[model samples]
Target: MSLYNPNRVNPQRPKRIALVIANPATSSSTGWPVGFWWSEVTHPYYVLTEAGYEVTFFSPDGGACVADALSDPNDASGYSRHDLISQGFLHTPELLARIANTTPVQDLVSADYDALLVAGGQAPMFNFANAHALQQQFAAFHAAGKVVAALCHGVALLAFTQTTTGEYLASGKTITGFSNQEEDQADQAAWHYGWLPSGQSIMPWRIETRLQEIGANFVHAGAWQSYAVRDGNLITGQQNFSGEATARLMIEALGR
Candidate 1:
């Protein structure tokens, strides 16, 4: 059915992609350290690297970034213990090395790469949303018609990013991201311990609500389900589980 064999071949001229993350030490409303979601960053990282794409990591403010505590495989909460790939990556120094040397947005030119990916986590609710600089950068990439990708809370920026034409980049595009329902489910599941909700409401506005207001063709598959959508070169994932799926789509769209 599919020509892709995980162990099979390699490409001589791999595609180049850039990854954007939030700066470190920013946390969620519940006080969890957050920058980028683990699966959202790592699964895609692993996929692109294995496919021979040259991937570079960057941050909004140019500094070290941290994953949400729940994303840590070794975390006492074990929120992410179920992620084998993350668990494996947690133990690999070489693989983890990229997170140590992330570049700043000023250091990158969108034209240098074939695609750009925005990662999500709790921190995005605080840092990425309403980020004028980040929106402008994404606008540049989107205007150039290069592949632009965002997952989970990272999708929040779509509501503010405007293309060179002064229109919201996603003004008429079909996309997907963490839905209101999923946020409710995750929040309801963690309420026993007094963990504050991570819903879209945290932002003065919610992602689903804002995206809809901006005329985005936003879709949702269901609670806790992996859902990713590609509208032309724009790739988006709904939540953590959708990260790997989104990465696979990017690879396909890049023809790798």
Candidate 2:
């Protein structure tokens, strides 16, 4: 007969990652349906999981989540037709179910995971920045010295998040996100294709501008380039294309 020890540590336990995605929303600036970007979530999820980390999906408001239309490979626009990773994720039942219904951020406990990642898309611009519960969870992960990462517009949360001392989390930290140039290009394409009103931008606010305003040392590469920044335990990707790079940086920070 053997007695089980409740407090025994399992050395073989896999590292867990909490991936926070934005819930569906109608973009006020463009009146367009917005949600998490396909590549932003799929790419990082692929990378992290391939590295043997257990990944869980979460959102500010849980339930079902949608992807930005243009980010879908099956979208008529063919905007993301080349995104095979996203396409595969969409086709896989288990992977697709991860985003179908997500755990609400309010239900998350920072101590339960080894790292936290926020995937970006247009919806984040409208929701993530103002979501108090999500911000607190992000801050909690940072305070716990866990790797905290964000991509594209997901970085919006970093601009408003605060440290325990009440200072902006990004203050003096080097970070990158969807840049003004990228936003301008996207808006121009939207207008040219009649998807956006003439003379209107697709986003209510720009991540780069807001982060710079908050005292973050914002840097970026050319538009659509794969660029990621690692400032201590904080990691950020420049745009959708930088997802894998960001995940790799997070893995590095985790010493895995």
Which candidate has the top score in lDDT? 2
| Model 2 residue 161 CA deviation in Å | 1.0
lDDT digits (tens) for residues 17-60 of candidate 1: 88888776444555555567788888898788777677788887
TM of each candidate vs. truth: 0.88, 0.94
* Cα lDDT, all candidates: 0.79, 0.88
CA shift of 106, model 2, Å: 1.3
Tens digits of lDDT, candidate 2, 1-256: 1123332234267678999999999888867788989999999988877777778899999989999888999999898999999988988997777688899999998777999999998898888757899899888888888899999999988878998899999999999999999999988998898887888998888888888888999999989999999998899999999999999999889865
- lDDT for model 1, on a 0 to 1 scale? 0.79
The stretch of ten residues in a row with the least summed lDDT in candidate 2 is 1-10
Error of 2 at 198 (Å): 2.6
